[model samples]
Target: MYHKKMKSKVVRITCIGLSILTLAFVSILIYSFYGSKKTIQPDALLHQYMANINDGKYEEMYTLLSEQSQAIVSQEDFILKNQKIYEGIEGKNLTIKITKIDELGKTQILVSYDTYMDTLAGDISFSNEAYFTKNDNKEYRLLWQPQLIFPMLNPDDKVRVNTLKAERGDILDRNGEVIVGKGIASSIGLVPGKMSDSKELDIARVSELLDIPVDHINKALNATYVKDDTFVPLKKIPKDQQELEEALLEVPGIKISDIAVRVYPFGEKTSHLTGYIQNINAEELKKLKEQNYNANSIIGKSGLEKIFEDRIRAIDGYEIIVVDSSGEKKETLAKMSPKDGETLKLTIDAQIQSVLYDQFREDKSCSVAINPKTGEVLALVSTPTFDSNDFVLGMSTDKWNVLNADTNKPLFNRFKVALCPGSCFKPIIGAIGLTTEVIKPSDNYESSGLSWQKDGSWGEYKVTTLKEYGDQVNLQNALVYSDNIYFAKAALNIGGDLLAEQLTNIGFQETIPFELGMYPSSFSNTGTFDTEIQLADSGYGQAQILINPLHMASIYSAFVNDGNMIKPYLIYKESTVPEYWKEQVFTKEAAQIVRNDLIQVIENGTGSDAKIDSLTLAGKTGTAEIKQSKDDHEGTELGWFSLFTVDEHTENPILVITMVEDVKERGGSHYVIQKVKTVFEKR
Candidate 1:
């Protein structure tokens, strides 16, 4: 009886325990399917909405709005407002963080967030609240408002931008005189009140004088801003166009007024150096949009204006204001003060520049003058140039077409370009020979006539010299005579490998140490001299040896500067000093030997035409043939003359190198020598 009672009690206890386990499993399944969703929906929906705003997806944001918010503001209006306020300020690099989410009620929630973005005016960071609500559809939606775009924004408020333009800096010379400065320009326009009875006749005459089309003037006259007494500006002309001003005044309806403009006082004389400013094109505007540039901004288009643009360009300031419906300022969101551009002073002498240009204005020529002792650039001139004022005021298509079609290439900049140096390069080889000790100053070579080849295997190839000065020639006589055969034999003595090594060590086929960009003086096109004939020809600057006009002048400084080439510069600073470009280029003894011979070259040799009674000069003259081969006769010739003042009495000593095209029948180097002599004598 006792065992049966114990078994019944155990069975009851087991049944009660199984019932409790079953109930717990059912409760967990209910929570997983429905309870958890209610807790996660609001936060996930809020996160997705915030992500949409950061990505600039305004349409998706509109879809996320609550029903009442959607009805109050239509989708199109919301999208436009978002796009304008976002893009108008040029916003970028956006980031948003949700700081907290709190429940206001079962259907409404308040979310705290921080927003940050970069704008054109400056950076913006703010904290705001996002209200989210659940509707009858049981889905969370945003409660949108103008405050969502900006915390302080309202329905009638406008995002206004105010720009304060900076004044462009002037470009000055070494003496602090302006090369480009603020000057007056004439505004050519029409006065409706002064129109004559024959208005068409007057308009046609004005149009012809100003080179503006008839339709352009008509459009300006018919503009909505035009009035019976208003001056309808048609075009701008140089202030000094007195002849045109007189002609236009005769046309009854024409009126002239003065306006401020960036003027080039030297006009075409310094156009290649100062360059010119013009309206910024589409490509430049797009590239510089981030720097506060607009369609109305003026930018440098060429020359120094283009090269040193960052230093001369103005820093335009901006203000972002919150304006009312009546266009009254309510608040300023961001502000920056206008900063003017900095001035650029150069080591240019305006007097020397003017002199060089005026002498070569009618010829295809290039000139570079520098202080050999200081390496300060005195003058740079390229002739047959177009006026920079034309570019500044305005340019007609016909005028541009004429300049482009001209065979002389007036638009091209010739200073930085490289050309064959001809016999003028003999001094460099002589210096190299002296440095290598392969050719002594008195070592003599038997003359091999005007032309000779290295060996019999080479056919129809020969190295030639201008004149055979002596039967037995040494280094000094070879340089003065520009004897190609002697240097050719000297180069053979140095061998092909050591000659190239020495040339490269002296900065051949390398970037010049100058602020201005220039093509390097190189030994050959392929960077190596392949044949003995080619190497021999290269010794006298014939076989693929080309040198920039500026660099050629710089190279001569080594002789006078204690065997160190001074680094050349254009822009001048107060603390700037003469720095060495290449040291130990030649021994001090070798330099003196070459220098003495150059003085004799001016006094008694080929360059005697450059002699003057009042001043002593040392120089070299060369005539380079632009032919396919040594004997090709149809090709044109280039005349070159490089000279420097050698006397101790000279005050402002200068080394001037000039080259002119098409001197074949015009006396060759003699023509250039006389021209250079005239320049010195005039000064």
Candidate 2:
């Protein structure tokens, strides 16, 4: 019985020994699997290394490299190389992916990856290969090489930016004439490096040929920053002046090239309408960067140039090139072609514009003419004009300052502002009286050379008529005689509030919807009449009233266009459909009656001096008084003549408005009459 019990104890000890052996085998397999995933696999090591690169963790990426790679590239060198490549790739997105991994040998692994990047050139994809070597500690490490960044990257490779310049579009007139264009011009200059003649003698000879001051030539040649290789421009010459160019070439150190310049065939005549372009300043660059503008770009500075900037601006292109460290070109990675801007065509009659400009050459005046039926602005003239080519070609600081300080205001656009309308506004009151049923066409009022009005709310005032018109006149005869006393009483009967509302409805104190900037017509009275004198004075266009020439011309255009005032436009591209007032400003019947009275004014009244042959003309004459000094009571006057003519051959009326300032000395109505007549006769 003792022997049997000992055998059972031996059996239990053997079972326990087998259980411990099985557990030991399972633990060894678990350890082997964990080590392979964490350190043995090349993909795991490569992924960790690339993660650091993606995060811009250069120092960490350097630590993951093999010992041999660390010997070849220092951490500082690695960081600098990567940073330069990253900076050159501006506006690009980068992403990385492990493509493939293969076991090469007992201690080496081949790793393949793809870099997907979005560059300005376009979406780009390329693959690269890396080898991870296992160290004595059984840890895999990445082998560093420049090709790891890009499959085609070389040790000496660098980046270069090439700008592809775009050509600006041309501006054309209605007759298909080139108003503004990129023309060939020669700049007379000297390359200091190539100059072998005496510096002083050469400068003297150059100054003589170019018709420039000797001091200017000396200053440019002796400038501190003027390098030996620098090309110093003395003056600009026309490319076609071969004789003058040959004469200048006799002087040593002279150089010339056919460079691009903004040329205007009719410079000063179309300056205000065509505008000009100039190199953008720092302040302008900041606001235009989003539009792909560069610091070296030129842009429109004023007038139509500023209004249609985007359409005329060029779209620049670029090329991404790979170069060596010494700035040697290696390969072109990507390229983009430049796109030229759209051509802009205008509705300007260059011949008519030139005539109007010639007539107003000596006077400080504003004149505008439009086709009443179509709202095609044929001519817009403002006197004391500046040569726009001066701004574009390059103006001296002194000359620019002189232009700004000129009393005549050569740079100021006169048609854009408001001025007193004088008796020219009488038609507006007549229209209001007729449309609002304030008076009938046959209504007559007793009038003399003068009349007086006294209001309880305001004070007493007097309105005097022109010496020509007598008493007891109807609307037609009153307009022909310009009877102020008659119109004043009519305005008082119509009330100021109604008159102000009518003016507002016709675009007073409101935007005129023109391409060029325009100031709104303005008046003080918004609601009710302050006094009968105020209404009467306003009715005659003498009570703090201001109206732009364009606005007045448009209003009268409605009278000729069957009570429809089409919006004025200059660009043909944007004016496909005619835009006019939604609500009619006058009835067709009222317009006809007013039109007949205007005809009488030209036929037998104040505007008779402006009569022309072969046409039935209609118009109004005005003389707005302006106090010379605020303290002085006596003032000069601004003479105005607004007229339109209709011929049997034409369906549209040719309308014009001319304003001549300081007209008392300049021959009031007669001066404006001759000016308008000269333009029409030229037409």
Judged by TM-score, which candidate is best? 1
Model 1 lDDT on a 0 to 1 scale: 0.84
Candidate 2 C-alpha error for residue 440, in Å = 2.1
Candidate 2: stretches off by over 4 Å: 1-91, 95-125, 129-150, 155-159, 194-230, 233-251, 322-332, 454-460, 525-531, 573-578, 628-634
C-alpha root-mean-square deviation, each candidate: 7.4, 7.9
Poorest lDDT segment (10 consecutive residues) of candidate 2 = 452-461
Q: List the residue pairs that clash in candidate 1.
A: none
Query: What is candidate 1's CA lDDT for residue 31?
Result: 78
lDDT of each: 0.84, 0.79
Instruction: List model 2 lDDT by residue over 394-502, tens digit each.
Output: 6665678889999999998888899888889888788878888897888867655455554455433457666645555778887887777778888888877787787
TM-scores vs. true structure, each candidate:
0.84, 0.81
Question: Mind giving the per-residue lDDT tens digits that candidate 1 earns over 322-378?
Answer: 888898888887777788888888898887888888778888999998888778888
TM-score, prediction 1: 0.84
